[model samples]
Every structure is written in C-alpha cells, then in structure tokens.
Target: MNDFVTVAVFDYPHEITVLKHLLDQAEIDYFFENETMMNIAPMYSQALGGIRLKVHPEDAETVREILKKLNDESNLKIV
Candidate 1:
C-alpha cells in the first residue's frame, strides 16, 4: 500500500476542487482531509488548518511539479 502525504492545504472549496480536477486529469491518486469538517463548519477552516490534499509519497514530487506548472500558466498561486 502507498502511504499518503499532504501535498497542499486549501481554505476554499473552489481551490480544492480546481486542484482535484487537475490531479484527476493527471491520473495521480489523491484524497482530501478535513473536507467534511470544513463543509460542516466553514468558519473553522482557518482554525482547522484548511482542507488538505494528500497523495502517495511516490507521487509527491510529480504533484508539486504539476501544481507549479498550472500555477505558472494561470499566473495564480496555488501552493
């Protein structure tokens, strides 16, 4: 089994959704933490440290690279 590690944390649902779509398209396995809690209590997003995006340790570098490329292309900071 692949051990997962957090690649990024996002306070907004839309941010997570955008990254999720990109990761999905890249076919990189991933999951999110604190999504339910954040959805249930959005105000706690900051206190709870936001939603976390996790990926297999082996995919960590690739995930970072992908995010970097996307951020560069869009000229938006994601990480």
Candidate 2:
C-alpha cells in the first residue's frame, strides 16, 4: 500500500516472499502488491511479471540496507 515505501525490487513470487519473510523475521512492517494471481497473469509476466513487495517510504532505505547486508553476508544478491 501507499503507507509503505518501495524499498527494494524482486523478480517474482520468490523474491517477494523472501523479502516479506525477512521483514517479518525482523519485525519490520511492510506492504505488498501482488498481481500475479490476482489481475495480471503470471504466465504473461515473463518471470518479471509477478508480485511486488513494498515498504514504507520512510523505511525504504532502511529495508534496502538490511537486505543488502543480508545478501552480502550470504553471498546472495537480492533482486
């Protein structure tokens, strides 16, 4: 929702869920727009047409930094 900012971006359902789970584990509140199985068909998304994970605009930088740090620690890159 607009209440949260767009902190980072993910490729598809997996990334969306992963980021959401991370935020949940950290107790950071977030909002998401999932049109995959809703309006826009995932089959047509071409791997990039899926859910969208959003965070509070104010928390955007914070969430991104945290995600980056997590990715760095695990040698993983968050989309």
Candidate 3:
C-alpha cells in the first residue's frame, strides 16, 4: 500500500461526508479510514470518532488547506 497523508478526522458522519464532498468538488483526491466506526457504534464514534481523510504524501499540505477551508465554511454555517 502507498503511504497516505491524513488530512482530517471528523467524528460526525455528516461532517465526514461533507468534507469528502468538498474534496471531491474541489477535484482533490482523498481516501477514507475508519468507515466501520461510523456504522458499528454511532454514538461512540461520534463522541470519539472520525474518518481520516488521506491523500498522497505529496499532496498532504494541499489537502490540509482544503480541509481547513471546508472546516471554516462548516463553522460559519453553524453561526
């Protein structure tokens, strides 16, 4: 397997999904980790859960920036 760069971890499935969509919309590639955690134990997963959004090591920083942008947008929507 290739080395992956973890960009973000979100406990909420909605958040994880949203982030995933954002990356897709941005045309940035990513992969997920901890998918079982989202379904097996939702409450626990939400409390201590999250999906690791990963990309190629070379695109790590770019992925992080995109995550930051999505996070900021998510936060603003909450306000």
Candidate 4:
C-alpha cells in the first residue's frame, strides 16, 4: 500500500456507492481511505480530506479513466 497513490477524493460515502461497483467491475486494485469513518460521521469528510481513492501506481491512470467515464455519464460528479 505504500506505493499506492490517491486517484480521487469523494466528499461523502454515498458518492462512492456506484464507484465501488464500477471499480469492482473493472477489476481495478484500489481502496477508499476514511470510508468507514465517513460512513460513521459524514461531517468529518472535509477534516479528513474526504474519502481518498487509493490505487497502486501502475493502476492509477486506469482508475482515473474510469472515474472520468463515470463523471461523464452521471450528473453527480465525484471530486
């Protein structure tokens, strides 16, 4: 995980619902930092720098492309 880098940061847990499914479908290696805490207390999202979408460095570009597609296809964009 030390080599993993943040690909994105979502402000709320709900925003990541579809994203999670998408990542799974794409078979991408990734994890959401602060996801559990955000689920417990959404207000702390900003304080914790939101829920970080961390991925292996090799997978970063792929994850970013997926994120871009998701954002392009949905009205609710992920930060």
Which digits, one per residue and each the tens of the lDDT, describe model 3 over residues 1-79?
2687776776756666666677788777677777667767767765654666778887788877876775575566531
Full ranking by TM-score: 4, 1, 3, 2
Specify the poorest-scoring 10-residue window by lDDT in model 4.
70-79
lDDT of each: 0.84, 0.63, 0.69, 0.89
Candidate 4: deviation at residue 63, Å?
0.7
**lDDT score of model 2?**
0.63
Positional deviation of residue 28's Cα in model 1 after best superposition, in angstroms: 1.0
RMSD of each: 2.8, 3.8, 3.1, 2.5
Candidate 4: tens digits of C-alpha lDDT, residues 1-79: 8889998998988888988998899898889999999999999989999999999998899888887888785566545
| Candidate 1 Cα outliers beyond 4 Å, as residue runs | 73-79
Better of 1 and 3 by TM-score: 1
Model 1 alpha-carbon miss at residue 24, Å: 1.0
Write model 1 residue lDDT over 24-59, tens digit each, in one string.
998999888899888788999999899988899999
Reference-based TM-score, model 3? 0.69
Task: Write candidate 2's Cα lDDT for 1-79 as tens digits.
Answer: 6566555555455566566677888787776565455345656444653456577677777787877777786666655
State in Å the error of residue 73, model 1. 5.6
TM-score of 2: 0.61
